[model samples]
Target: MKTLSKKDIKQLNERIGREVFSKKDLLQEECGRYYRNKELVFFTLPQGRLAPSLKFLLKDLYLPKVTVDMGAVKFVVGGADIMRPGVTACDEGVMQGDLVVVVDETHGKPLAVGEALMGSEELLAATSGKVVKNLHYVGDDLWNA
Candidate 1:
């Protein structure tokens, strides 16, 4: 397992407003993805510790490097929500129906894995489409959840 930095962990704790021991310690898995019971889990996963006004968790795993400035944690560990305004960056190679990794710009981490409603650039530049609504946790199969 990739060990997270203590400094980064501290920031995450501050942003989340909760004490964090480790990244793995904060998650629970179901099928193949991991998830947190709380919303905006990214708040507790950033190096800034400051709560991100906007963010997203898109992907099968977390980046633990990508951080954002403002935005809500759109996607959680499990398939949850993915608002348009919260989207920061997307895989340019993704398609409207392809599975893609959504990320929280604030902390630069994958928030959730979901079907793409729009492509990467479109998701970033355009102002329409689902852009990624169907989200599933890295391990929790929302299909079953």
Candidate 2:
């Protein structure tokens, strides 16, 4: 692990559009290049964009949310893409390509982080199809890392 310089932390804050933990708390893992603070971990996605791990997102709770029914919990935790039928609610401002948290409706606990396949309005209006593409979840490599 390596401590991140102030410059690196500043750029990360810019990329995520907000200030995060202080430099003293931020470390970059050597193996996966994942960024870690005292509280959470995040990493670059396959699309080459930075994204928070599901655990990090739970602590931060800043992403727009896609709420799913209890029935969908199993599939969601298993890394299945979110299907329209299982979605119970969505934050209004979500847009296509936006990062969103997938939460269980019952407890409002985040289950995964995904990229929106459709806007919130469209996702709620649709009947049956894959909507959000699951990118990170509880048992995924990122979570383990």
Candidate 3:
């Protein structure tokens, strides 16, 4: 693991729209690092995108989220793309091409991170077919890495 320089941390904070790491936190930090903060949260992505690890979702950070019914939990955590039927709710203002966090309705815990295939309005109006392309999920290589 490579430690992040001050500039990197600053950029990351900007991308995530909040202060993620304090100077103290940065002392032990590194780029492309994933750690368990209750679950697993990636400190950084290869492209420098900051995303909440599924475990981190439990804290309810203010990222765009799509909630799926209990019936979809197994498939979502297993890395299946989010289909329209499974979605129970969508955070308002989600747009196509945006990154979204996928969660289970029962616990509101994240199961995966995905790219929206449709806007929130469109997703809510549809009854079938894919809505979000799953990018990272529990038990995927990134999760294990």
TM per prediction: 0.42, 0.92, 0.80
Q: Count the backbone clashes (under 3 Å) in each candidate.
A: 33, 0, 0
The residue pairs that clash in candidate 2, if any, are none
Pick the winner on lDDT between candidates 1 and 3: 3
| lDDT, candidates in the order shown | 0.46, 0.85, 0.77
Highest-scoring model, lDDT: 2
**TM-score of predicted structure 1:** 0.42
* 2 or 3, greater by lDDT: 2
State in Å the error of residue 79, model 3. 0.6
lDDT for 144 (candidate 3)? 69
Q: 1-145, model 2: which lDDT tens digit per residue?
A: 7767878777777877888657666577554355665434677776678778777777789999999999999999998999999999999999999999999998999899999999998999999999999988978777776
Question: TM-score of model 2 relative to the true fold?
Answer: 0.92
Question: What tens-digit string does per-residue lDDT give for candidate 1 at 5-79?
Answer: 556566555644556446455443222223354323332222322222123333224322221124545345435
